[model samples]
Target chain A: MQKIFSYSNTMILLLLVLCAAVFYLTGEMSSGAELFPRITAFGLAFFGIVELILSLSRKDSMEKPIKKENNQHLVRKSVLYMLVFFLLVIFFFLCFPLIGFEVSAIGFMLIAMVLLGGRKTLRLWPVAILIPLLLVLVFRGGLDVRLPTLFF
Target chain B: MELFGAVLNLLKPLTFLAMSVGVGWGIICGALPGLGATIGIALLIPFTFGMSPLVALPMLAGVYAGAIYGGGITAVLLGVPGTSADAATVYDGYPLAQKGLANKGLTTSVSASAFGGMFSALILLFLAPPLAKASLAFGPPEYFLVAIFGLTIIAALSTSSIIKGIMAGFLGLLLGTIGIDPIVGDMRFTFGAVYLYDGFPLVPLILGLFAFPRCMVLIEDLVRKGSSQISLNLDDGGGPKLTWRETWQMKRTYFRSAFLGTLIGILPGAGANIACFVGYASAKRASKKPELFGTGIPEGVAASEAANNGTCNGSLVPLLTLSIPGSPTAAVILGALMIHGLVPGADLFTKHAEVTYTFIVSAFFCNIIMLVMGWYGSKWFGKIVQVPTYILAPAMLLVSLVGAFTVRQYTFDIGVTIGIGTAAYFLSRAGFPMASILLGAILGPMAEAGFRRAMLIGQNDLTIFLTRPLSLALVILTLASVFAGWRMQKKSKPMKDALSGKKETQ
Candidate 1:
């Protein structure tokens, strides 16, 4: 975990520097636009250097051999759960305006909740209906904020 | 006499009513699990739209002050703090409740909170004018230095690995640099996506990065623990509550914590949680009975309550003076003001002095409300712990989603929030400081803008930032802090190594 963390930090820093370099070049090439990106670039590069130096110094101390105590933990399940939720969110965003806010929110919540563990059908049905309706009414009615609605 | 007149104006019938209602709503919200000051203020902001910004701003200020103190009720009685600001309160408060001194714990928390809040308000009332006057002289170079000063503190507070903290801060700045350029009007990294034009919506991104990821962790914990059932009992109302005599005994502790919290809160990017944590640690170190801290010591409750409440008021300093929010709750309040068409800055004090002063005075009154409400409502509010997470989690998620949508009626915002939340979860899992990262994002543009402008004015000379007196002083301060943090990390290395070695041997 520590090694992965270090590597990710370095890669992110490098990516930022690369972007900054691009911005630097595309900018006015003089004191106008280029100046800011260059300053930002150096700021990032300095911080990156500091991080790299610190990580190197601690690498020996951080490198403890991993101990595996039964790999059957919910770690995999949690990651999969996150991935599924992400996909569902993307789908909802794409489909919500088409199907309408009320329908999509209800559908998404019901599906997501069940997938997470709303096995009690009695509880699930009410929540599936009530939650979305309450949200729509409160937002649209109370705040006068409009949602993408199927009904006029 | 001027202060008295200002106070009197704030005490007008409508303002008083607004303060009471705002504080009352805040208390209820803060006591409920998963709902906090941020959500409470967000929900109330739209309602305040009908009123003058003067009236609405004070009411929201009242809400902000009330909510921070309100969290302590659950922290003491239920052993569950409703907000992160109250997390330190449980260190001493729960133990006291378990020892049948629940009334005393509640008393100390309420009193300390009131005292801290009042002190901070007093500071804001008096100190803000001078600060605003000084800020009138600040140019882009000075702002850049100030931003760096704020970022340096992250390294100081960063846990164990400063590297990860720096990484988070840099990543936040990078995030800030996305979207269209503020000065040149050129698109930087939007990739022709209009959602990227407005940059990341601060509300949704903040909510996701902070709140959503926390909920995920809570869910993960619950899953691992296999439906852990929690039993909660309200504090017994039998004993004589802490008297003024006991309060006086801890006056020094209350004062110190409040002062430290206010200072922390005034600094851009520092929040109530950090203030409370530092207050608790400092109090423990300074206390005669340090070992008794987590076991329900009055000092512990006093320190935590004082600091958290102090931070609430302290955040207003920068908000009113510099137009920069000191914390997330403050950021939300900024949003509320914007929704009401009240742009914050220099002319606000001149153009809206009455409103500003009224808001400050209302903050003072807000503290009193928290004290009174905490005393009378603790028994009722403690009942919230009886509510199960299965019901609470979904409701909270719904609110989160709605709040995100409200920022911009686009589904793209919802996606951004979920994405940021997920990324935050992974970053936290890998030991990064999300707060630092958030702070970086919040302050990055300010720093970048300032740096660029300074360089331009100086004809591409880097020395301009270092040559000016105020800017130079800030740059030195930032470098000094960085040096100090580096030294502290080096010092702790041997101790951490020994601990790890001992664990291995065991």
Candidate 2:
């Protein structure tokens, strides 16, 4: 059961499903428009299946059970950190236009630095503040390129 | 006379200033671990949006040249390669530093880098015009086949798993088809967003793929291994001086490596990363003291640095003439060219001769600038590697996202960049080559346009790609290239394993 739902096998299944979805969606397009996407979808599916088979045949399908067990906690912690980082990015994206580039960027930088273990130090605060201000000044004043600003 | 005029244009104060600043920034980026030439250029693309093509393109070229040379600085001093292109330099360079001959290693690397860069820049100057002229004969069928050839070569060579690479490329092609159908104007996958009318903007996409993932990795590293800054101590005055006589004696090594690097760079998929190793191995093979290669030698440092920097201009040949990017950095430059409304072909030579020629000629001065900066600023550049990942990661993320926003001035572009970057990070973790995906996105439209046009021309006959002599030649070449790339990958696997094993043992 584990072998059947392995990483490579799952990736292959996802790719095949994606190919089918592309073909289904492009079904409404004219023949000329659909031709290239169809070809690419088919090629993707073909390679995905080939890789799946190769992965199944290989002895290195998964790490040794002992190593996997030992590393599972570390893996989970890393994944958690990744999720936090991603959520922060999403938050920054959502707030960017509302709060403007400077406020949001500086906020994002501070939060990110703190999350990445800079909470113990005062060093990150100045960098977090100064970099956004400097970027705004340079982009707006030096290059005359506008960043989203509350006043503007 | 045109070449002379191009030189004069490059000497203009603004152009020269921009070029020098680019070189300095590139050196800093290259000396820093994690940020290399591609991301450096990607981040700089937004700033170049306001400048003239003459000022902008040469500056980008300077960055490329300087980044390649700058990688050797950290490789010599710290034993860590600042970029993949400097991996080979670490073998001898670190040992030289350990032996208190760091000055010689630094001088040798800079001198050789300058020589190789100038050598390849000359080749690009003389060779690209004739190649562009030849490309003028390429028709729709030939173009379609050429795009296919580029994709296949990249897929075959970019990764250990060719199938994974090919699949990543297909995914990129699929992404490219999302906005609107070029031929029939049918909206395929835009999902009703008006911003998706023209598809994903190239600048943001490049930045997201190349820069964002690196930022993520840096952040991840900070989390995994506590956020301690790297510390360095260097004694600048304790190394033997590299005399001109010593440098002159390695002329044969310089010539051979530079030639090999240029040739490798002209081929799609291969870049400075491969060229440096090839140069190092070739030099070792030719040396009477081959066994002493990794044991602190100026020749070894010179060989790797020379070949890698030689690739700086060599990779531009195909990019400027055939619309085929010879390396990932060249791909970014291709996006820059498109942003400036310049197409790569005989049209560049005939219609935009001044811009094209000036850009090519600027490579010469860029190399000279790289030499000066690298020689005098190695100490300062080496210190940049000490920046903490905590600060670098968040700063990079902010800069990259903002750069994405600047491209189209749409908040949506930033969202799209973040989306693509997140997907790219996952895809890369799955062992798919990002470069293959990038090339696929870049060439997808070209392939689609060519295929549709050729199909129309041949009345829906698919063999139109094979019927023309030029198309037939391209088809044959594509097949040959894929086969060669496969064999090369197979051949290099053991060597790669051995090198990794050595690193582990060390």
Candidate 3:
């Protein structure tokens, strides 16, 4: 496998130049906002490049040998958990208008908790249900904002 | 004289009560592992939604001040370090606790925190107008430079490699850029998900990056070790007390650390965690017994605690005077200010003089509350560590859900929270600094809006960015910081290598 950029200054520099280009082309570069991102990008790139050069030139290595983590299983589990969360979110967005925000949100949380290895399903049930129900009541009922109810 | 009246008026019963609640809550949450002052303020924001900004702001500010001091409790007692800001305290604090001097460590922390909070509040009250003028001189380009200057402190933070730390910061910035382009309204990395329109929700992302991942990792450890059975016998009480002799002995260190912390806090993007470590290190080097630093000395505790609390004061100077938030907690406070329809800037002083004075006086009030509550609640706060991770995890998750939903009453925001939380977790594990990412996310839209407006004023000429003296000086400072950081890292590498080798050989 080809080694990707190790988040050095060069990559940062490239990102800044890209941002600058994007800002310039979008005709938004004239704003003071463009200046901050541009300057940040430029400075980050410069420092990163210098560091990269310094590492190449130095005879003695200063970095400690990388001790890679032996948690690929954990990483995999987390990644899978997140993917399930993403899909659940997508499903909730679709179901919200039909089923209502409170119900969908509750369902989303319960599923997400279970997928993320939430043990003690009994404990999870009340939290997953009650929290979203309280929010809809507080924000919609108390604040009196129009929320997506099935009939409304 | 006007300031004196402002201070006197703040001593009213209502203001004192608000200050106590804020500080008391701040310390309690701050003492919790994976929670900090920012979360403390974020959580309380909902409760304060009904109150007037005058009452609400001080109440929240009290929490901000209290939490920074409170974090030292966990650092000393459990070796957990409570919030990330108190991580430096662990060096001396845990050792002190082991030596059965936990009360002394706790006392020193409270005293230093109070001193630092008072010092910074004084600075804010008297010197804020002049500093506000200085802050106003900064344009977008200058703020961008300030952001870089903030990131340069990563060198001080990096114990492993400068390369790794810089990588983490840059990746964080990139992560900050992941959402829709603020100027163009085009999504960059959302992968066709409509929920990511606002990029990441700050509270949940932070909670996930700092809290969630830590909780997940700790679960395995807790299971393996079986949770440590440490109980706080609340009756074994050493009440709130600090000796003048002890204060005088550490006065110089306290002042120096507070000054250093305040200065760093004034700079955008940096936080109290960075300040505490810097203060602790500088104190150790200057101490008579530099070798005795990690052995639970009062000076080290004073340095860390003072620096941490000093940051709270320093951060507000910019937020109130210039509308620029120095840290995430300050940023959340800015949101709270906006929620109350208060825009921070030059007008903040003249237009809302009473409110402003009330806020300033509240700082002093909050500091006193921190001392009082930290003493009274120390034993109570210590019991929180015994709560199971399983319970705390879901509770936090539930809070994050509500926090997101409450913001706009949009389920979309809650969805955004989960997405942002998930992405933030990955970004953090991949070695990105969540703080920088947050800075970028929060400040990106501002910079974009400002830069575009400035360009229209100058007919799109890039030279205008440098033509302004404030912008030019900021550029120079930013350059100097980057160069200085690189040089510092280069110089420190060999010493670090030597130290590690010495340990290995022993």
Candidate 4:
């Protein structure tokens, strides 16, 4: 056998399990309010089951080994890049209210660009500096949206 | 006449200034790969609270119209589509660019978009009330069926796989249940978090499903082929220039696709992407030289451009007449209206007639401005695709994060956005349609409310849906749609494969 399950089948199974678990955990509530959740969960599980069953009929082929290997480097790099991005975003989120939009905005943009492309993107200096300032001017100055503040 | 008066009132300097700014921002957003109109509207919702309905509606509508049209530039000049709706445009548009007929492709696209936008707007103006009047007789059971009809059509036509699309939609409905119950204030899946009480905010969910997934795709492209630049040369422009004659020649394609787009937009769950696909496919099928499609053909550009742009007004039909958003971005627009203390539906036509008429009328003028902007600015807007990934990625992420934060001014919303975005990335890789998921989320509340209302009205009798004529008809339509989708898949297997092969090679 190529595997116990295909990748999609595994995800479908996982989703089915989540549905069952969520439905079971709902306990007893006003029947009407719970009705939508119950119906949707049940429906999702039904489709998941169908997907799982259909996935079994698919035969995995080891075709195009060279192409797969060639793609490995790019896929790995891209995954790493995304992880780094989200981590930076999370840090920005954490520091947002405390350090304020102005500081975090500049830091986030500069750090993220450097991480993604090194110093080759120094040419983007103007755009990098201007965008966040423009956002502040529009949201804070023009619209009077109250951002978490450090400096006026 | 009242609508004309409302339009005239919006001719003031302040209105034009606001609209110009909004349209300019929208064009820039639509030209960028990861940023689309939904985020544009989401960020603007909070800001619109400060402006009058007259000023706000025109500005938002201008943004809406401009964003839809602006996508044509990148689709023509670069192989990359500015928006998903413009993906079909990339098929013909990019080929024209490679042949140095970029101006022709760009002009055809802009003109098609303008025609489609104007046609759909006229339909909305003339057809909304009658279409809505037909729904006035509809009650709880019919409402449930209407929601079900939306889900069924999405499930059937949105993806290559019917079951997967339905599952994706169902997953959205499940997420929609995360907040407080509409009928009874009990929280089902809040898991003891105060944030869950309001459910997942639509902005976060939309970004997660629609916007963030693109980031993942961008990452793959960036990694596989490091950032690339567009090759531009106006002196070497070798292909036939677009003429008024060619524009008129494609009028048949324009009308058919425009009508198709508008009708699809009127359907609750349908959006611009689906409209473009159908329009392009139908255009190819109806062509004498269908073989010429995707070969930098003007007909191909016309179909996609018109259909995708047509959906703007097509979607407004249900949004204005019924208060049900016809697309995800339209849902964001609905939020804008809500903040301004204006509810859609019959009340808008009566109590807020001025605002309603102005909003509808403003869409017409917005399209005109969009046409002019797209025609003149194509050369500049088309250059946006050449930006380095490192630069584009950070800018898009920062703007998106900031927009997400501004909505509720909460960090938790950002978490939700990122989490959902990650899930959407994986789901898309696994072949689930994100549009279906978005539709599910948007339609969930309406479906739930309708079901609950039906139960209360019918005293727990499930037969009420079957007993009501409109509901029963809708139920049949839903089933028919599913069957039609099955047949379409089976019949088009060879054609679809052939088309994809041709598209890739060209």
Candidate 5:
């Protein structure tokens, strides 16, 4: 057990902690609402503990090595870019209710395109602008699906 | 007869137009790397919100059938399987391409795919109603067990460790418990957020799991290589198309593989890739010249195509019959049905026969269209592989954001979706089965509702699940599936360890 703790299965440990926190939060709920959550929490804890024990018992199970070839699994990129994409998305949606849909979406697309390495071409601006405009037309005019719009 | 006519009447210009366009777009998406039936269907689901069931369902069916066949295009020409469903094709297909038989590989694959797709559709048309009728007898305890059965199948079929899959599933179920309780009005896990009242929206959750992750992946690819595009030799004009005589020779291979695929697909948790590989192995075992399978053979391509496409409709059988999705794609379809206020079950067949019949009938036509379009559209489809990731990534990001927001016309869902997508990306990297997470979330609510109702009725008797015949059978099946899967993994691990250079256990 001491040896098990010496090797860090960091992600699994994090997940276990998260599970515990979620389970503890469920304590605040009414009994009617808490039943299913409690069941799921119990499941989460049970499987997590079992997996930890198994992971610990395996040979050199500390942290699994990454596959170099599988792009679907491990991505080779800087944390800064990942943070940029995440923050860009978070910021755009945060400003959405204030600025409405078209303005925010179009702005989000243009900025994200530049940030994500879309080439600077004459076609870029038109595409970034037109997709949202065309979407507004099809969904709003044709489908009557409401999208938040601003006067600007 | 009128119902048949009504079903056939989906041949209207609008529906036909939608089918062709959907199939064409699906072929393009599928021919591209990292885009498959799941992403294609998820991206298109938003567009279906405005259209009638007749318009929308046919379009979806077209995408489903066409995207799968489209995957074979990349596997043969580029040596990259467009989807995991097409992975089996790559072994034999790339070899054929190298031997200057790209045309034949493409032809055999498309033809076999069309055959397999149509065969499964016929089975769905003929077989679904009776199965749905049988499902009418399922009580709450049975439904609960059915969900368990589906989860077990997933756990069994997980390529990674079963424990990790179950843990991911548990995490998903735990996430599902965030909204108002089914039995009572009180909220659980809301944490004072108004958005939590409706629970996590399906659109955001799905987009986060499947779509957004791909977008981020595309961005990562762009940064890694300054926007890379798929390049292939289009100079050969693809050698020669397969003759009818050659196709006729492979008839047994096609039918047997399709049957195997459909049977596997009918079982919960066995996805198209599993069907593809099993069919490939079966075809090899039954072959007169099994040695030639990986050496550029038409039989290999045909078997791979037939099985993968066969699973397309086979996976739908359980979804249409019992609300238990047979695969991840079927899970998305289940979500679509629920979104449209059309739950899958007995009522889907009897109450909404017009929509249900029309949906199944459309799949038949979609297969025919896939054959027509796939055979002729190979040249244009190949060009889509060359499109740069930078442009595609931004477009997909915008679409995913819009898709999540428009589903309920809430901007909060967009934030929620991106958050889930980021977390899902990390989880996937950690060797968790992402699809297991998806399946768990989809089935969690049903399991909870059934469990609660069964409890209320049985006065908290857990034996109600065991007492009912159908439920008991399902319980046995689930346990057997998990055990068999565990045993199979244990058996395979030694071989896997010996084969792999760097063994990573999760």
Candidate 6:
């Protein structure tokens, strides 16, 4: 049963459902406005259904496991690292408006570096501190594009 | 001649500086894993806002040309491809490096890349103007069909599964229909968000789709590998150079691959990644001793490198002439063109000939600059692969997010980038091709506008597309492209399976 519902097939199913929702939402739009969206939705749904069917019928529907028994710890660590990175990004974005770009970016960089196994190196400290400052100078001072800095 | 005038423009101090910086930066970015030509150009687009089109467009072109060549450096030194375009180069390049012939491989790559790039630049210089002139005759129906044709070709060829590829393209089309309708001005799917009113901003979307996911992957790799430092035993000393006789011997391979690459590049949706493989495969077939092809040979490196870089300017032909981007990098360039208030097609040749010609002429000098820099800097570039993934990944994300913010000065745009990027990462993991989505998004408005206008012109006559010769021809071509893509997928299945099997074993 797990083999029958592969990742690709699941994605196709989700896309098909999204297409149906899109098709349903177009009812509020004018016929002239909805024409293209409806057609696109129809096309998406059709192909998605075909893909789902094809994927389900294949004998090798399940992707071959490339992971070795010994690599489980490594794989788990990689996923954890990815989650930490994603959370750090979210935290950076959330903090940007509150604390400002320079402080938030530098903080994000330092924490990310440490979390991603850069704590052992002396270079990480300077890199985390200097990159944001350099970027501030380049973007705000050089390019004249305003960044969200707390102080001028 | 305008060509001469364009050359003169490129020689200006500022323009020349911009071109050199773009090329050098492009090389660094391309040599780094998880950052390729698409992200390189996307990250640079924000900075181009303050420059004149003359400086901006030429610089982007230089980056495009240089990055394609730069990927070969890492391919030779490391088994990992810096960019997908360099994947084919890895077959011979890594073997050569293993045999202590890294210098010879690097030199062959630089020379071949330069030659192919210059050849295609010449072709673009001559071919684009006539094509632009011809495109002037196209009506809305023709444009509609052309957009359809582009979408179909992109969908069919981008992935192994035609169904999946087309679905991805249609998904792009659906995403593209989110904003107000072109003809009626009715908000179709804005859902009350004001940022959604203008549709998804191109810069953030590009960065999100192409850049963020790569950064994430780099972080993942860092965790799995458990080492920031790559053990390097590179032979930096001058080993053996490719003599004139050796270069002359491979001249046929260079020319044939370049020609094939250029033709593929001129086609909408095809890109350097595909061209490199095709070029390498054809060279293998034609080689007198095919069995010796991937055994650390200069000819194999030359074939793949030349074809990929040949696509640098070749992909710009359709972009400069028809307003259709031939590849993902070209799509980003198209966004840059729009940002600079330059439209594609006939006006690019007439009203903006100076800018257009300067951009084209810059490609020639870009190749020369790349050749010189790559020759001298290959050793340094090889070391770039050793940069800590922890630092590199976070830095890229920070810069990309900030760049996204600078696009419209809207903080909301940053969120957009993150969201789209997250979704794109998952989708890609599920075997969806990002290129198809990008093409669909870029071509969606064009397709819709053309379709609506043509309908109005024909008073709702569906057969209006069939009435015109060009429109009918485009329709046939679209179908033929789909058929070809299907056939190619069927033919390439064995190869793909073999390659995947090899990877699993490794």
lDDT of each: 0.71, 0.83, 0.66, 0.75, 0.80, 0.83
Ranking by DockQ: 6, 2, 4, 5, 1, 3
Clashes of each: 0, 0, 14, 0, 0, 0
lDDT of 3 by residue, B137-204 (tens): 66666655454444544433444444545554554565455566666556555567665666655545
Candidate 5: misplaced stretches above 4 Å?
A: A1-8, A28-31, A62-77, B2-6, B225-229, B491-506
lDDT of 6 at A30: 65
- Provide the clash count, candidate 4: 0
Candidate achieving higher lDDT, 5 or 6: 6
Candidate 4 regions with alpha-carbon error over 4 angstroms? A1-5, A28-32, A59-69, B33-53, B79-101, B233-304, B322-344, B490-506
The order by descending TM-score is 2, 6, 5, 4, 1, 3
Q: What digit string (tens of lDDT, one per residue) describes model 2 on residues B171-263? A: 878777877788888887778999888976887788778788878878776666666656543655736667889998999999999999998
Better model by lDDT: candidate 4 vs candidate 6: 6
Q: Give candidate 1 regions above 4 Å deviation.
A: A1-35, A59-71, A119-131, B1-67, B78-88, B160-163, B235-257, B263-300, B322-345, B352-355, B437-445, B484-506
Clashing pairs in 1: none
TM-score of chain B of 2: 0.95
The TM-score leader among the candidates is: 2
DockQ of each: 0.34, 0.66, 0.17, 0.60, 0.51, 0.74
**Comparing 1 and 5 on TM-score, the stronger one:** 5
How much does candidate 5 score in TM-score? Answer: 0.92
Docking class of 1: acceptable
TM-score of each model, paired residue for residue: 0.81, 0.95, 0.74, 0.87, 0.92, 0.93
Q: What is the overall TM-score of model 2 with all chains considered together?
A: 0.95
The true-versus-predicted C-alpha distance at residue B193 of model 6, in Å, is 2.4
Residue B279, candidate 3: alpha-carbon lDDT: 93
| Displacement of the residue B442 alpha carbon in candidate 3, Å | 3.2
Better structure of 2 and 4 per DockQ: 2
lDDT of 1 at B81: 78
